[model samples]
Target: MASHSSSKIAIYGAIGANVAIAISKFVAAFFTGSSAMLSEGIHSLVDSGNGLLILFGVHQAEKPADARYPFGRSKELYFWSLIVAILVFSVGGGMSFYEGVEHLKHPAPITDPTWNYVVLGLSLVFEGISFFLAFREFNKSRGDAGFWATLGRSKDPSVFAILMEDLAALLGLVIALGGVYFGHMLDNPYFDGGASICIGLLLVSVAIFLIYKTKGLLVGQGVEEETLDALEALARQQRGVEQVRRPLTMYLGPQDVVLALDVEFHDHLSAIEVEKTVDELQDTIRANHPEFKRIFIEAKGLSGKQRNPLAPDPTSPQI
Candidate 1:
């Protein structure tokens, strides 16, 4: 619950920063008619939209399990985070490209350079602060991993996604400032259009990268191998667990896992003993692995036959 609250707060901060940056970039673009500034404005506007989606997702994900969703609503975060990534790619990247192409075809004069620089400089500072907050939140879970590796491997996609967005925003600001300075220095609008195109490409790359990473989570990727190995070790150490045949685990949501295991017990163990063993194993798993939430234990005889009458037949086709 505390983690969810923290996530919500971080997303809200990102939303606020993006909204302010959007307004600043819009005003700067209006004053200068700079293609790069305009492209950045669209980027921030899209970021603002993505931030709102993340905020909504975080809230929805906090809902408890119900009849309709026995596994809980945690996956809502992944779904909405994916939607946010797509929006960034389409609205932010696509619009930037379209504007850049139009600018290239029909060059527009950038009348005022001073205001563009001021806005870009201020945006860079604001985005840096926002990005720092995201970084701090991500580090809470990252432990010893490097920043880039943490971004790639962290279970919480929101912080990493926002970090990428902020980095892109910072790069866009640099591109916009460069375009304005070079356009004025070289007396060429083409340079400005080219810079906008570069910014668009950068945003597209970042968006696609984020989508690719988050798609794995949406599709029910397995827990980390290290986590599984740890769970297996814990189960093996239990006195009644003869063997852990197959341990299957999947991420139910960020930092939440559902674990299913097939275990063989001694042939002479009574039904009561088996139940006690299973309960002990479940408790051990939960105690050792903070991420594992729901555990399902399938007890098997020495001959590898399931003890439960309702267990699915091995040869039966699954739906």
Candidate 2:
């Protein structure tokens, strides 16, 4: 719950900054006729819309389970994150690239770059603030983990998505400043168009990276291998258990996981003893890892035999 609140904070900050930046950029682009400034305006507008979409996804994902969806709607966030990536690639990157090509074909000089400079400088400060907030929240979640490693392992997309967008925005601002300065100094409009093209490429690369990260979550990625190994060891330690197969686990949300385990008990254990052992194991697991929202335990006799005739086939894969 705390993490969710923090993520929302970062997202809200980014949305506010982007909205302000977009308006100013559009105004400056209108007056100066700078291709790079126009592209940056579109980028900011798209980013604002993406932030709202992420917030909607987070709200929907928090819905309680219903008969139609027993597992809840936690995966909705992943779906929306995928949509955000597609929007960045198509609306943001595609438009910027197209705009740059058009500008190059019929180049026009900027008579006054004063408005462009003012808007770009203000945008830099706003985007910097947003980036700092996102970085702080993400850093809190990561603890001592390295930045790239934490990003790869993170399940929450709102914070990381904002972080990535702000990074790209900052870089694009720098590129736009250079384009304006150099085009004015050299009396050449090609430099401005080239900067827009470079910003388009940067946005495309960021979108691709976001798509790759969100894909795994949507496809039911499992817990870390070390986590699985620890769970298996814990199951094996329980008395009356002869062997324990590796457990199957999948994250339903950032803090929700579903776990399944197959345990082979001694043939001599009575029905009551087996029941007690299963109950104890479940309690132990819940105490150690509360993130597991659902747990299914399958008990089997030694030598691949079912303890009860009604039990599932022992030869079939349980995990």
Q: Which candidate is the best by TM-score?
A: 1
TM values, all candidates: 0.93, 0.92
Residue lDDT tens for model 2, 112-231: 899999999999999999999999988987988899999888888888888999999999999999999999999999999999999999999999999998998899899988889888
- What TM-score should be assigned to candidate 1? 0.93
Error of 2 at 131 (Å): 1.1
Backbone clashes in model 2, listed as residue pairs? none
What tens digits encode model 1's per-residue C-alpha lDDT throughout 134-161?
Answer: 8778889888888887777777867788
Candidate 2 minimal-lDDT segment of 10 residues: 308-317
Q: Candidate 2's error at 1, in angstroms?
A: 2.5
lDDT of 2: 0.88
Whole-model Cα lDDT per candidate?
A: 0.82, 0.88
Candidate 1 segments whose C-alpha is farther than 4 A from its true place: 308-319
